[model samples]
Target chain A: MNGVHDLGGSDGHGPINPEPNEPVFHAEWEKRVFGMFLPVAACGYFNLDEFRHAIERMGAPSYLNTSYYEHWLHAFETLLVEKGALSAAELAARQQQIAEEAR
Target chain B: MASSAHTRPLSEVEIRVKALESLLVEKGLIDLAAVDALIDKYEHKVGPRNGARVVARAWVDPAYKARLLSHGTEAIAELGYTGMQGEDMVVVENTPEVHNVLVCTLCSCYPWPTLGLPPVWYKSAPYRSRVVIDPRGVLQEFGLQLPESTEVRVWDSTSEVRYMVLPERPPGTEHLSEDELAALVTRDAMIGVTKVSA
Candidate 1:
């Protein structure tokens, strides 16, 4: 099996020579997105009876348009706010504080 | 008991959910073990193996190939693997005559039903930007050296659609059963970076 970094590069030729010690944030993000979807899995979204029909109707265009994390984050954020688990103001405040700390 | 200094600090939302789940566990509303089992079930059973099965079936059966080309999801569903992630999937066939590759140019719009999850590289900005312009180069980086005469086509997956490659059956293995054929089908083969071989 080809490793994740084993795909794509310049030259249309040569073996994958990834930079050593380079952060794998991109790959890590993919796993994190999958982790975020664990709740959906637990909620029976992946069961044969529930999501099968929906999966059959999903289009390629929409799937490609959204990022892995964006999908989970969108669902989680929306549901949390709707269920009163989180408020818009609290989320905004947390985001602002994180941004401020970064600066 | 006081909270330990080494305890992890969770976000407010995380804390709330954790508390809720703990309450459920205490009240027997849900079993923690069951949650762990459910997660394990999907993570292991519902991933790239599905795509591998489809690709392998296409390799051995001409009828299945026709069905896959015309209706990939329905054909895949015939294998008892149907649902949302596989819903918008398109199966691009690679023949000795033509090679097909898949990519999500914008983000990683993977066929979760079939592929379970998109690999990190598939979602990375570097891949999205570089794959379309230099597909051959990208394949080469994957240690796949195709003949210059072979044409390479890249399908960009989107929010509504996902793609999987139906790799051509390699020669020298005529007697292999369906399961054996599936074993030869790797994730990279489905991605067009590598060919399935016995």
Candidate 2:
């Protein structure tokens, strides 16, 4: 499926802000997400295309608001549910735990 | 006493990753240890520095540059950098007459081995969508201002192939050695979002 992830020449996205001495990753969560996404992806539930499509499959509000790795995070949830490894209810509960803990 | 890691709450993505990782690991679907190692490799090793080495080598060796432009995979593999998403590499050279920039209109199909993980902007919706439509305007945003006579070619990478930009070597830098030249090559230069200069 051609998703929003494919942004080859549309418009309205803003300027690119580059950092001096940029690091490979900025945050700890980013690293964990990348590590998990890549290996689980290699585990064969879906090919690269399927994985990307899962990201594309996200609702517009969530997709537009999410960061890059957040897209990967949402995709992980989507793939797990789609592949029968997870359920929407379970993901919702996990998200709730963090939300409640932060309260 | 607990470490700082415990005091700080994980981000939403981090929390989800932890939850998913535990679930996946419990199902015997993935090896957490191995995943950690892979992240370490990308974080510490196999980064833009690796691509910088390639750019530097090409700058010093004309034949190698020719081979790189013609057979990107083999030339890159010669440097011992080869893997998924980069198996079919296409090295486009940025010259005085033409400038080459890379974007994955479909998704961020970047060369992981050479450039490491793409920048946030590379994966952001704006960069993905805007670069192809108005490369000159986008170039201006990236601080690259090319003359009208110079052609800006934006390569839209598909799943079949990935691309890397070979930036033009700046003038008066001939005295620098191959390693030094490579040192000057930035990831943006390689992506054709910017240039390499002294």
Candidate whose TM-score is highest: 2
Q: B14-75, model 2: which lDDT tens digit per residue?
A: 67777777777878988979889988998988788888989988989999999999999999
TM-score of each: 0.64, 0.92
What TM value does chain A in model 1 reach? 0.46
Q: Which digits, one per residue and each the tens of the lDDT, describe model 1 over residues A1-103?
A: 2223222332332333434323322343333334434444454324433232232233545333554444444455455455555566766665555434433
Minimum summed lDDT over a 10-residue window in model 2 chain B is located at B1-10
Clashing residue pairs found in predicted model 2 = A6-B105, A6-B106, A7-B128, A7-B129, A9-B129, A9-B133
lDDT of 2 by residue, A43-102 (tens): 788878888788788876777788877888878888879888888888778777865675
Taking candidate 2, what TM-score does its chain B reach relative to the real chain B? Answer: 0.94
**Candidate number achieving the greatest DockQ relative to the actual structure:** 2
lDDT of 2 at A27: 83
TM-score of every candidate's chain A: 0.46, 0.79
Candidate 1 at B154: error in angstroms? 0.4
- Candidate 2, DockQ to 2 decimals? 0.56
Ten contiguous residues with the weakest lDDT in model 1 chain B: B11-20
